[model samples]
Target: MKTTNYDIIIIGGGMVGASLACALADSTLKIAVIEGREPPAEWPADSFDIRVSAITRASENLFRHLGAWEEMQRLRVQPYQAMEVWDATGPGHIHFEAAELGEPNLGHIIENRVITRALRQRLREHHNIDYRCPAHPKGLLPLIDRAQLQLDDGSRLQAPLMVGADGAHSWLRQQAGIAVAERHYGQTAVVTTVQTEKHHQDTAWQRFLPSGPLAFLPLPGGRSSIVWSTTAEQAEHLLALDAGEFMAELGEAFAHRLGAITALGPRGAFPLKGRHAKQYVKPQLALVGDAAHTIHPLAGQGVNLGLADVEALAAVVLDAHRARRPIGALKTLRRYERARRGDNLLMLDAMGAFKSLFSNDTPGLRELRNLGLDLADHAGPVKNLIVARAMGLDALPAASLATS
Candidate 1:
């Protein structure tokens, strides 16, 4: 088998992996990005993708830094100015505005395909990056001085550092024998695009129900993207419903906040699970994105968390390279681990707590949460801080690529 060498071997070329490559564009390091599947050349402009993400301002900063944000905007993106969260069980509600945060807008609602496409396009501009699509890693080996990946075609790639950005079921993580702790939320996230009777008003709305949270994220037009988290049985029921019935139920659950759902697009559902690796780094290896941790989508922090990993890992790796230190050394990888592991765990735990707190129907618990929401709404400073964190401002600063 022929062998190829790279300064870094990224085992997945999804958004996170691809963004990492772009983040290191100015570096002289030779990199290889192995991706199993390739995204479509272009998406239909008239229809929207069912899979979408709420991109925080910090994430937007990273994309802008990478030179992909403009293209994404050209393709399609919705800038949501406000977020409204309420407890359906009580009269407790909280709202956050971009003006309060001293920002242009809170975040963006962009299709997953749009992000991937834009990142992929950016990947092509970096001369140091070798992107291999329709390629799968058959195996991975962590060596004393290098980590190696064996593709199904019998080609091998070696690098001082290897990254597992493949996803929750990370093949690289599994091959390297990293253990993961997983908790099934026993809920499924049903996602789709819909046209609302009332415009979404460029606002993000989430209503907590006994079953789970239903979020309506604004889109470019009067359309909105919805994520409905609910029990498995109920999810199946929702999926099985015809368009009319589903729209009726959806409108009712959302309290017609956006008025009726006049039109429906394709629907998708995936099981929700919280997974965190026992360790984020090992000799000659590191993990990022869903490979490192996954949280419930109720908060839409999944991709933001992944982008933060990209920022931190890129910074540490660039720093190491400049210092002429071993980028893959355990000591060096640990820096990235230390910077991200604690934060990821904190988010996972918080999501779990929110899931438990909102999914309960106890009258007293409902009242307490409603009161908590009320208090939080009135607590301006505290609320702004929380929203800022969500915007990726307060917690982790954007990654710096300048040689330190």
Candidate 2:
């Protein structure tokens, strides 16, 4: 078969991979992207994609650096000025306002599809990047300095660095003989959008119930996007409900905080599980995003975590290339792995702790957590620290978090 060579080949064209492509666009390195799905031709400026994320200021800055944030802004991404978290069993609640941090907004809630499309557009503008859609890597062979990839088409590509941004079931990671530690939470996430009777006032709200956490993220219009996490059986039942019944049930579930839920869009459910690869990099291969680790979406930091991995990996690769060192050298890749492993583990542990803490039915534990929230709310310095952490400022001291 024929063989083409590239400086780097990324095996997933999702936001993380595409952002990595864009970040490396200005460099002379030749990048090839292998994606199973093609990007949309155009983004819907006013519509909402069922999958949305609460983008932190740090992630937003990374998007800006990649030249995709302006396009996201053009697509009418909604900036949430405040976040309110409460529990059903207690009067304890907490509110985080962006003004406390001297920022205009806490974070931006954007449709996943819009961000993906914008990243694709940026990738297209880069002459050094080559994107292959509906393609898969058949196999990978690591060489002394570069790695060779065998595509399903029987074609071959060689690169000094090979990245697996594919997902939780990363084919590249498996092919590299890397093991993963996975745990099934037995929960599923039901996501959809609703047209509420009252405006959200640019506030994102989350309510902790005995079953799971339900988040109402404000959209550009008066509508709100809902991410409800519950057990598998419960999620299936929710999905089985008719539009009218679903809206009614959802309104009741949410205690109608935004008033009556008038309209409901299509609902989709994704099984929730936690997985982290035993190793993030080998001789010439590295894993990013979901391929490395996946956390619960209860905090809405899943995508942000993936973006952070991309940022860190890209910075390491760029630095190595500038130093005239092999980008895929074990020493260089180890730097990326070491820098990200602790942060990833920290987030995974935090989400797990939060999930276990909130999922408990014990009265004492409930009271303790609720009281903790109330205490944090009443303590100004504590509240500021929590808000900063949630805003992605305190997660890691990477250069990516520095305000531009």
Name every residue pair that clashes in candidate 2.
none
Question: Stretches of candidate 2 above 4 Å error?
Answer: 43-46, 395-404
Q: Give lDDT: candidate 2, residue 322.
A: 78
Number of clashing pairs per prediction, in order: 0, 0
Error at 37, model 2, angstroms: 0.7
Q: What's the lDDT for all of these models?
A: 0.90, 0.87
lDDT of 2 by residue, 312-338 (tens): 888888888878999988999999999
lDDT digits (tens) for residues 335-381 of candidate 1:
99998898899999999999999999999999999999999999988
